[model samples]
Target: MPAVLSPTYREVCLWQEQVPREPLPADPLPHEVDVLVVGAGYCGLSAGASAATAGATTLVLDKEPLGWGASSRNGGMVIPELKAGPEKLAKKYGQLGRDLYAEVDAAFDHTEALVKEIDCDYVRSGQLYLAHTPSHTPHLRDFAGELQRSGQDVQFLDAAQVRERIGSTAFDSAIFFPKVGGLHPAKFHDGLAKRALAAGAIVHDRTAVTGLRRQAGGFEVQTTRGPVRAAQVIIGTNAQMDAAVPELAKRILPINSYIIATEPLTADQLQLIGPQMMVDTKNLLFYWRLTPDGRMVFGGRNQLDPVDVPTAREFLYDNMVRIHPQLTGVAVEYAWTGYVAMTLDRLPHVGTVDGAWYATGCNGTGVSLNTWLGDRLGKVVTGQEPPPAFAELKHPAIPLKPLSSSYLPMVGRYFALQDRR
Candidate 1:
């Protein structure tokens, strides 16, 4: 479960980029607890914090130090629902689907509230989905209809209108959703972990959950440090859960997502880009926005790989220029990449396995979805009846192949080539 092979994120511009990281000690874990949660990212930490506050003896474990996974390196866009459009979700779940969206919207609200209460740097500036080509415009307009039907405040724009609002002629059209926003992901992750520790949750970092056994009344988990027995278990590992639970791993593909940060620009330069967060429509998508520190944080993914600095810089720089040619002259201050879990359906899998509980496969929607799942999983662990929406959810297994690891490069290259169209 160590993200030793996981992707890295840029170290400049982000609020928590080079902040002092808490060390995960080599101490042994105690033998028993009321709850044992795997993975110390947002979902695990949030779940642990809630459980501990409810007076449950909770313990959280991670294979590497905190902030070592997607939780820390993600784009921090807290989009308040699944990747599926409203029309699709409605067709799929009927009235139940609408109710589910409401639940997720509440999840996003809880995240903002928690950030404020914890004194984390959070914002509600909103997010825009930009369109670069004529063919892309229709999709954005259709998306606006679906978003409006979902009870979201969405505005569609033409090329001139978008250019006026964003100060860039790069987009042919765009969709703005006030409900979606951005944040400092790493800070939020660390803040949640700190609050969990303060509330009496025992968090073990650099600790890997090596084995699992079904006990008579509960489950016993083995870690690198020692063993832990608990009445309930939660898995918040996402795509990184492969070695820990192979069955769940096959259902989710871990893809490398890259991000780049520019040096702080002058107020005049920032004015050229305007203030909102924006992403474009392409099979291989890219998102670019101004950080609170006045630097541009741009990101997107076309494939999965073990990304390094050189490859990340080249890939991101080339793609960024296609959207905003003026940025061709801008210097890249930093570049990094991280792996995210993607499901075939592009929806998160939240359900129980045996007596073990789990919340994984957020696709690219992990920021808000993970927090929501964490809150829901916390309720489930405390024996409260889970919401009706989660009852019918199931994890569709991922097809495994002998050449799976080697499969990334080929799939990625194909998409990269196709994205240029």
Candidate 2:
């Protein structure tokens, strides 16, 4: 018999393999609901649960299976801040910036509480942001000082300290956030789905919402299955918004991020790399963490164009080896790619547009922010709370829609050059 070849792309990730399989809902889709939630990722599910709790008849619809997008595909780091530093944020919005920081801090606290309540394998191992070059150390220091002023518990580690903690000499210095941590993304997504279902929200997977039109009551949502007349509609399809909502698509530039997981490592290998979620200080960042099962999961940004799985796997593996040369010969067990929604301002936007509400544009920090926004939007729809402060910010559409794909590669190359310097 001819030798069997391993598949290049993984059908599912390591996190998906750990969680119990989610079967499609058996009940038929209702023709009407109080609130219709599009996209069953973290945000949608979170909104569904909160809406149901607030006595709204909520239904969540998704094009793929639950947790099919970045919710399950992310690096699983619960970062509470945006790409912008604290000082920049304070300088820009002043009091509003401080309020935004407080909200994100609450999100971080809520995430830890939710993880414990959901009984998932979450580690409070914290996170380390490494400086990729000597010149980056000052930036890290400034960032740490700003965070400290904001009441965040952060420490700046020198090269020797970084090596002691990370067991790698590739980084120059590091900023350690003692509150951040990692969790099983698929498991957390599953927990949210179950909570939503239990809270009386109907979940319909593999049911894509194609269009939305304002009607007499609220909006008529056109879906693959049928039309759903909802009193209100919330779009939570971050990064995967294709043709569903043209307005949202214009505001979000979807970029692909790839990840690779190595085979299970020994106890000694685990000790070499300390138990902390790690990321580098680069415009095009590289993030990595050890899974609960002891596998090294490393991820980074890739070219804007479509890339084959083998190529993505090779690229991620080379970067992983560059960080830790000892893992040179380790076999990669899984490789996958997911889309990240990038906005013009590099911040998340949550507000109403054209009679429909939305919470998206995570800009690479989605795990905690998505959960908070989803729940907060649900409250806003139910009249339980006001719109978040982020809703006040302007969300402008990208300049040229037809030529957007070429933009990311150019930006990535520029950032790569800066990292080399």
Candidate 3:
């Protein structure tokens, strides 16, 4: 961490207006409810709002405050494709693959509309997915051709074109997606929470769920506060998954990703970085973009396990400088970590596991997908609609089981090595 004083290394959200603060107050814990949604992040709260609107007595509970999870910590890039592109998904699931991609596309539109409804500094700015190595550029170039033939709003940019857009030679080439957008994640989370509350759902913060079991006629949720009975439950927790539901824990691996925000850049510096959200093709990839106030927020997951924020900040700063040497020694105003939920399939899953509904596995690009899936879950639980196609697919459990964390660092090291090659 740069020794330069910038409010004393507290883990500030940077997107929030206030500094570290208390969790918002909530209604009294309900002894019984029609729909119980765990986790108050984007997906959970969205489900709460929808369930409540559908006339289900809903309650959303969280272990931490409303805006204290990856939902707020994420870069707020609303890219609507799954980890696999439409073409790849089409190859995998045929017509259902195309339909799943359409669902994600609808998610992007829903997110845009919701952002507008909430007035959260939404920008319809396109995104640049850069090729991190020379070997990757040719693949992206060919992939861009595939996307174009399928009528995607995409373009292939050679190294020269990429430099014109990014002012960085760190990447070899890029694929542009004009439909991507950016927003204030914290605002969106808080706004969605408020919407949930206004819809007559109760949101309780700082309430940790210890266990959940289906009982006669409903499920009993054991929490740090007390057990609450619900006719239906949605295990909407993403990266914060714990042993509350062993089935979810078996499938979701929580990995830490760090982010650092530099002091507001100069006009000249912004010119160098360009005004678009960006990500790279590396296994341990990098994502960056300019905040509305011109601060550059750079994020990556070079290391998956826990590390002190200071160490992560320095590593990211070194990488940031390597990517844009112009930012060398720039004051890092904030550094924080958020967990990304990963599964063996590298895709988000929505299904009824262990007799409870769940939508986990964002794979690091879930701002839009989570909200959409959560909303779909709300409707599904309320008998308004069926589960999305993703639920019908098989959800694979990670190999190595409970001992996976012991060898996870080795996997991280291998990914870093692959990024180098």
Candidate 4:
């Protein structure tokens, strides 16, 4: 397959993905606001909601309708913590590891609370990381042990126990993290946007900002519809963020992640997948879960390509049937794809430049980390003390070098190979 060819996003966002929405009208007036947030994805919505609620005249704009990006188009697996475990974190960040973990835990809690006020169809059932191979089982155990040693709550399940929970004998072991869970991402973003609007944020969907320039006291944004002036600007778009800032665009590369939903299966077929969100032990990293409608949603990493509905559906039909042959007869009802902002370190970047602040590059953990950083960034903008946890993060400008522009494919292929091992 070509490196850039990805399936369409509509196919697998969720069993019942939110439908396309009409655009919100442009801001009637050009006025200065306390904060100007770009990208209506989770990060923007959360930050905009918090900022507007905190008494700032916040303005949020998106290229597509609200929740049209990866925020509403993702796997919906709410895994907490950095992709690396404590051992790797310590190796990479030293003393900062503990603080980061604490903040990640807090992020999980924040997501739960945010979901409560909205109707996102959230389920706190937690997540199960299954190891299909015996070799992978030790990694899960060691990671769970490290988490426990760091005073986090995680459980290790043996082969038989894993089968009991997942209804699959394909895995040798599993690690369950109650802090992580699943939800309907589309609903969450939409609900949050509404809350932000109610709290005084001026949201303009289908409004893409064409240019940004520094002005006297703050900045000026030129949009397709009109201009927005704000003392401070925020870029909340994650993986779908392309060219908002040239430096950030280099640090974060967009990769296509595809998913497909199977038609509602019979009770017998539903038994094959229990009430658990699963990420298998493969470099391909298949994460799947059973939808409320008894349909199976399966996702995997695919090349970034020009995608459409038909192409996405075909890809899902091929991929989903491979995981379970019994699902061969199960027709695919949807196929879709989304962009994830992938960083070199797989950690989110949260900082400011000039007078513009940004929280991007959540990698694949935008659902939790974006909301976490949104709340954190809101505090920073409001002159309130930011949580000490984020103090450990060293906000350096992402390098805009040749390797960043040219070597992403090579680096991605290497990491993909490692994940396969």
Candidate 5:
């Protein structure tokens, strides 16, 4: 008999298999709310929870099932990382740059608190960042010292040490982040949803926001169910913001990230690759880790802009074998794809656009950054505090916005070529 095919994200995600996402029951669409949050991913739910706790009547609307986006589809690696390091950031924004880094550190702290509260299978398994080539080794070592000076418990690992940690000689040197860890994304999302509901925020799944117009009092948000008047609005849609607010969408480029899980590995295979979050330094990088159940979950970029799932699976599988040839013939048990928001400046942006406040452009670090910024935005919406330091940073505009899609594939191919060298 022909073998049955494995389930892809079109059916169910491996991480989400444990915490099933059933559609939310239909609910009354209130005519008015103190705050309306569009998108029910990590950012929206977090914002809604904070706003409701601040005594606002908050409503969170999503076009699909809860955690249906990148929030649940990510690799679950929690790194309090920004694209620009402290030095470059200071050079760019002065004292505000220091505050930006501090904010990310606080985000990490928030995740640590949530991991215990959520009871997700979170392991404080350390993280390792590898240098892809010898030429790139020294820069990473220096960066480790920079982070150490800034009070992070980061250490530079030599070639022998890296092999000892990961059991692979594919890398020359590496940096170890002891505080970095991994968790079940879907479980965390489930816990967050419960938190939002307990805090009195109403979450309406499958309710798409069609239009957002600033009115005299505040804003008239048109959803598929009906129009709701909102005293304040927060856009947390990230990659899907185009459908809700077109002008705001122009600020971000949606890039597709794909992942595949190999069947459970043997004890010997597991020993060859220690179970920690592993990422290599390349323009087009790869990250992989062993799931709690022993499957090797590997993820990376697609070769093109528009995702072809079959092609993504093949590409990732071949690359995984290239990195660790032990599992060349292992069957892939799962596959999935999610869109990551990339800003021109390679950093997240938080502030207003089209009169509605927003926090987006996670740049592949959404697991921690999104939740923290969303909480801050929620508080700001209810007058709890001022705009976050990120608000002071510029949201770089894309050149030739209408033609970005046409040029994305070209740029992706360029990055792929650079990865080869």
Candidate 6:
């Protein structure tokens, strides 16, 4: 097995330090509920909240503590777009593609509303998509044009303007989306979980679902604690899937992504990078932003192999210094990793099979997409409305499932090479 980080290292995620830990219930989970949702991340918790609000007896289960997965470990960027470019989507799916983009735009609106309702430390300072190579500039321009044509707010920045905004000469150009923003992910998760509980959802942590099978009225879900029977089950486990849901495992690939956070910087040091969520245009991308406490939280897809805190700190720090040589000897105080699920189409999917509902494959846009999809899934399960267009789209299983473990690393390598070019 790959070396696992010690408990101290695992606590390195800066988000975990921002909120007080909520205690789980000692009372045994009821014999059953109207709905049993798996995974306690944003999706599961949001789904639980929605279901309970609609008067369903909802219970959320997670293998680890609440908000312990990518929900809290991510870079806290609330971007409203997908990995697939708008032009490509337009060419392939036409009006449907455009509609999907609109849905993503609305997701940002939904997120903004939630941030306000929850009163978390959210900033609408916007996002910068920097071009890592000169050749990538035209693509950024095209993307900006597509956004403008679709009636979205955007601005294109030249190399000099990019340097002025982010204080980085590494990028050739950039595209700015005024509506994109950042937040304290763990705090947001905590607020959402509290809302779910307040809405009458029981959340059980350290309860991993071991087996799931169809029963007479609903489904029988076996967990570490015991068996749970529900009229419906919603699998919100994005990239952290194991054997609990074999069907979902075959449809998504779980790739490791890492991040490193530097010690809180001086106000002068913070001036080197302005306060905006920033990401570079690369197949294997690099994204960074300033934490609310003024730390530079930098992250990327450096490698597919499992990494410990020390190794990740070194790798990400070296890359950070390359982007901003002024930070050459900066201290990296934290390091952590999260699993991001990638689908064959690089888009999120929501649907049902064998009387169970699921929403997964966020492809790195989980902060916004997952939360939105979770609410939609709740409505679907409650018979409130139909699934959205993206959910109705086919979610095909990945090819050659047996070799994915060996093949994904090679795929990562190919993307890394492309990023260099």
Residue-level lDDT tens digits of model 2 in 297-319: 99886555557666777787888
Question: Over all chains combined, what TM-score does candidate 5 have?
Answer: 0.95
Question: Which regions in candidate 6 have their CA more than 4 angstroms from the true location?
Answer: 1-11
C-alpha TM-scores of all predictions = 0.92, 0.96, 0.96, 0.88, 0.95, 0.95
Summing lDDT over every window of 10 consecutive residues in candidate 5, give the lowest-scoring window.
1-10
Q: Candidate 6 lDDT, tens digit per residue, 78-133?
A: 99888876777889888878777877877778888899888668998799999999
lDDT of 3 by residue, 1-421 (tens): 2323255446666876432445676556989999999998889999999999999999899998768899888898989877777789899989888888888888998898898778677898899999888999878988888788878979889889988887888888899999998888888887888899899998899998999988998899999989999999998899788988887888888888888888889999998887778999988889989988888888987766678888878788888888888887678888888899999989888888767899999999889999988988999999999889888778888897788779888888989898887
lDDT over C-alpha atoms for residue 348 of model 4? 77
lDDT by residue for model 4 (1-421), tens = 1112234333345622544555676547456788888888777877787888788888888888666788777777777867788777777777787667777788888898888898877887778888867888888889889989877788999999987776667778989888777888777777777888888888888888776788898888877877878887888877766655666666676767777776678897788666678787775577888776677888776433335656655665665565455676666657777777767677777766556777877767778888878767766776775644554566554455444646655655775667655
- Least accurate stretch of 10 residues (summed lDDT) in model 1? 1-10
lDDT of 5 by residue, 1-421 (tens): 1112345324346887768877787979899999999999889999999999999999999988787888888899988878877887988899999999989989989988878889778888889998988888888988898888778888899989987776777888999889888998888889899999999999999889999999998999999999999999999988777767877788898888888887789998898888789998887778899988888888887554766766777788887877777776777888888888988998889989777999999988889889888888999999998998999988877788789778877988898777766
Task: Write out the backbone clash pairs for model 3.
Answer: none
Residue 87 of model 3 has an lDDT of 89
Clashes of each: 2, 0, 0, 15, 0, 0
Worst 10 residues of 3 by lDDT: 1-10
**Cα RMSD (angstroms) for every candidate in the order listed:** 4.3, 2.8, 1.8, 3.8, 2.4, 3.1
Flag regions of model 4 displaced more than 4 Å. Answer: 1-22, 27-29, 302-319, 387-392, 395-420
Question: In model 2, which regions exceed 4 Å deviation?
Answer: 1-11
The better candidate by TM-score, 3 or 4, is: 3
* Clash pairs detected, candidate 6: none
TM accuracy, model 4: 0.88
